[model samples]
Target: MTPCGDTEGDENCIAAIEALFKAYGSLRYGEEVTQLEHALQCGFLAQESGAAPALILAAVLHDIGHMLHPDAAAAVAADQNDAHERLGAQALSKWFGRSVSEPVRLHVQAKRWLCLRHQDYWEQLSPQSKRTLELQGGAMTAPEADEFERLPYSREALQLRRWDDLAKRADHPTPSLSHYLGLARGLLQS
Candidate 1:
């Protein structure tokens, strides 16, 4: 994988990201859809909802840490928490600002927060999500929920989490990765 850094140019960053997706985006972590499918669906949902550019990009790339991990599918099969949220946010920080990375960082916490805040949220999750939730520490405690709520991008994270949950439909058509890559390039240029 190409290591993206602060010194890299925009094309390099985009190439690195595109390469990562191309390489590992086919792996499924107990989900019906591939990683790329989920990403495109989530990004399409965000765009349909009229989300801002940063948010749209965040929705698209939220699960990028799965690709970044050395063996994310194996980790999932082993019933381990890969902490993809942190990894994705850290990797994305090299090119994207907090508007994108923070939401990606907080998305897992948002899942935990949703479980705490909504009575039926847990029931709505897919089996894969439920498995990951257990691996991800189940739900947040009351204090943890309060702390998470206070974070700057917490609300955006929650929104992204919703899209994440819904993006797993098999054969659901959405825009290509290039579309979101275009958005990312625009964000970088701006």
Candidate 2:
């Protein structure tokens, strides 16, 4: 659980991920579920959906940007756009390829994409999600949506987004972070 910087091929990546959750897991993610709970649920949903290991790993680590930032919950609460998606992607990219990092990078946009594609999607979001949606550039326009859909890994991103939406059950049980770390380690380039 020691703090580890993002270094290429370092053995610390999985440990860092685990440590992050242990440290900040209890913080509410603008929802009833804590950050760690949300992540575990998202990864679990992906696994249940028969998603690839890389995709499941992406789901588990998508919000890593928030963890990388200092007082991320406070920043979100203050309405500051910390660009957690970009930050998280940058961090994950050091260990994984597009199959993993790409989806994490695009997961936020995928949320915006969903809001545009389905009218009910926006209304279904938690209050915190709705607030963050505004900061995430609101719904995508037709041209924007078209561009997003055209991007490589966009489909995966969209699927990840769906799992992200469904991952907020406070009472849901999921495998431990270590279980996922083992799965993700097999997928890591290092």
Best by lDDT: 1
Candidate 1 lDDT tens digits, 71-183:
86676456468898999998887778899999999999999999999989999998778888998899999999999989999999999999989888889889899989999
Q: List TM-scores for all candidates, in order.
A: 0.92, 0.91
lDDT of 2 at 166: 86
- Residues 15-103 of candidate 2 have per-residue lDDT tens digits of 77887888778877765788898999999999999999999999999988887888876874575678998998888888787899999
How many steric clashes does model 2 contain?
0
Each model's lDDT? 0.87, 0.85
Query: Candidate 1: where is the Cα deviation over 4 Å?
Result: 1-8, 76-79
Per-residue error for 113 in candidate 2, Å, reads 1.2
